[model samples]
Target: MISKRAQQLQPSATLKVTGRAKELKRQGKSIVSLSAGEPDFKTPQFICDAAIEAIQNGFHGYTMNTGTPELRAAIVEKLKRDNNLEFDAAQIVCSNGAKQSVGFSLLALIDKGDEVIIPAPYWVSYPEMVRLAEGESVIVRTSFENNFKLTPSQLEESITEKTKAIILCSPSNPTGSCYSKDELAALADVLRKHPNIYIISDEIYEYIVFEGDHVSILNAAPDLKDRVVLINGFSKGFAMTGWRLGYLAAHPDVVTAVSKIQSQETSAPSSISQKAAEAAYNGPLDEVLAMREEFKKRRDFMVASLNEIEGVSCFTPGGAFYVFPDISHYLGAKKPNGDTIQNSTELCLYLLDEFGLAVVPGDAFGEPDGLRMSYAAAMSDLEDAMNRFQEGLATLTVH
Candidate 1:
């Protein structure tokens, strides 16, 4: 028999659906995919050059288990410059990616039966990671009416002696909602009441925000800095997904516990990657600004187009590249092929097979009546996907 943990784990539905879409694309189909999560931009030339230089310089040996001192120092400096938070290199642990950084925090902090409070319509991996750590997830339902944000009262009501941590994702995935400074402070107040629970602020999309400015929870309540483990990475901000570099800025004890896990598991993030990441954090500012501005334009275009479609309503995402729209109006309707689309998943499948446009269904994000469409594709690709999607839905008979 398989281990009980293996039995309990469900596969990532988002990625699973995406793979199916990709399969169709590889089968000589002319597909427009709206299921991407990464930026359409390529990694900067300078960052790649840095990695190549590191390899030539023989920076290939195993460095510190946490990370190289040089890389950690650069990260520490970047945090100070961007977030106004200071931490020694000893407090940082560079991991393979943001997922590992998040997983490390959970592994270090969670005990069996302990609960992590996760807001719904969350990133698909959050609850599963908690379960893998043997921690229960106490799901708090955040609503579109409230812009899919968790109120302090929701967190307050959910806290208990068994609660271990609150996982916060800003400019959130799927929904692209960002919390304001005042809103983050409200959350801080709730956490202050429950000191036993730690906060893992996942800021992987920090630089991708279209809103006025990013308000890091660490910046909001500096007094609670020690209790907050700030999670960020180069993947989204630097368009470096394949680089596999991410880090956590946290209390030393937490870093040490995670480092121990890394030592036995991954040993350390790639030596070359650590060097490239250092360059990413310390290098030119203009490239980062350009990427952010482009994403903003794309977000605006995608949301506007989606909103214009009949029977579909979408909010302008504050950040990130995804538009989550309410698609209940089309459900229970009949398609041109005479098949009835009863839910979001069936609707997504209908679009994929009929119009050759791929999108992820919302059932994975805790909303079965909506669909997630990513604008991370090129502008032309996004335009095509939207048009095809609209036509696909138009073929459906009104119920």
Candidate 2:
């Protein structure tokens, strides 16, 4: 029998929506998909060249379980240069993308029944990771009016003695909400009072900000450096999601503990991918910058266009590639066939079936009656997807 853990865990809802869209395209249907979470751009040539070179030079053999010393040093340098945060290489551990780093962190730190405080709408994998680690996922809801940002008071209210850690994501996945320095300082104040609570700050979308210098929770209060685990990677920035290279920076003891999980589970990230990641750190960052500008343009257009549709309210995000628009006006709405739109899933399916547009329902991200539309596709596709979505919403009759 499959483990109960595996049975209970929800499949990635983004991929589920994306797969259906792909199938429709394969079946010769005209589809407009905004469900993808990855860059449409190709991996930059410099990173690819390094990976090819590594493979040719016999990098197939596994090296150290944590990572090659050179790659670890490169990540340390990149973090310091890009985020203005300093950390020793001994405080870092390489893993198979940010997912593994998060998974390992939970596995290493969480004991059964311990609570992990997460702000919603979070990346889809977070709560599952906490549950898989035998920890309780204590989710704090964020509203559409604030672009889904969590207030310090809301975070404080969620805390209890059983709270072991807080999962923080900047340029957050579902809503693209980035925290300002002052905002992070507010959160830091809450953490400072709780010495035992660790902060797992996920900065995977660091380089894709639309405006303002990227702010990190760790940078807000360097005094709590030992308590903050900084998670990041080459995926969103360098268009290197396929490479699966990511790492974490924390206290030496925490890194060593995560390293043990890495050693036992993944036996370290792929050697070739690590080499490619080093190139991402050392090579030109211009490609990623240009891509960020393009995404911002698309994000602005999509947010505005979605709001033009009747019954939709969108918050223009400050970072990341997703725009989540509230569709709560359609809840309890009657369809053409008389079935009421009770929640996001039914609404999402209605759009997918009738208009051939694919969007992940917000329920998967801890918000119902909203849909996550990714601007990760080309502008042409973005324009088409919004048109179809507008038509789809027109089919519903709501109060």
Best by TM-score: 2
What local distance difference test score does each model get?
0.89, 0.90
Which 10 successive residues of model 2 have the least lDDT summed? 211-220
Clashes of each: 0, 0
Tens digit of per-residue lDDT, candidate 1, span 221-265: 998888899999999989998899999999988998999988998
Root-mean-square deviation (CA) per prediction: 1.3, 1.0
lDDT at 293 for candidate 1?
90
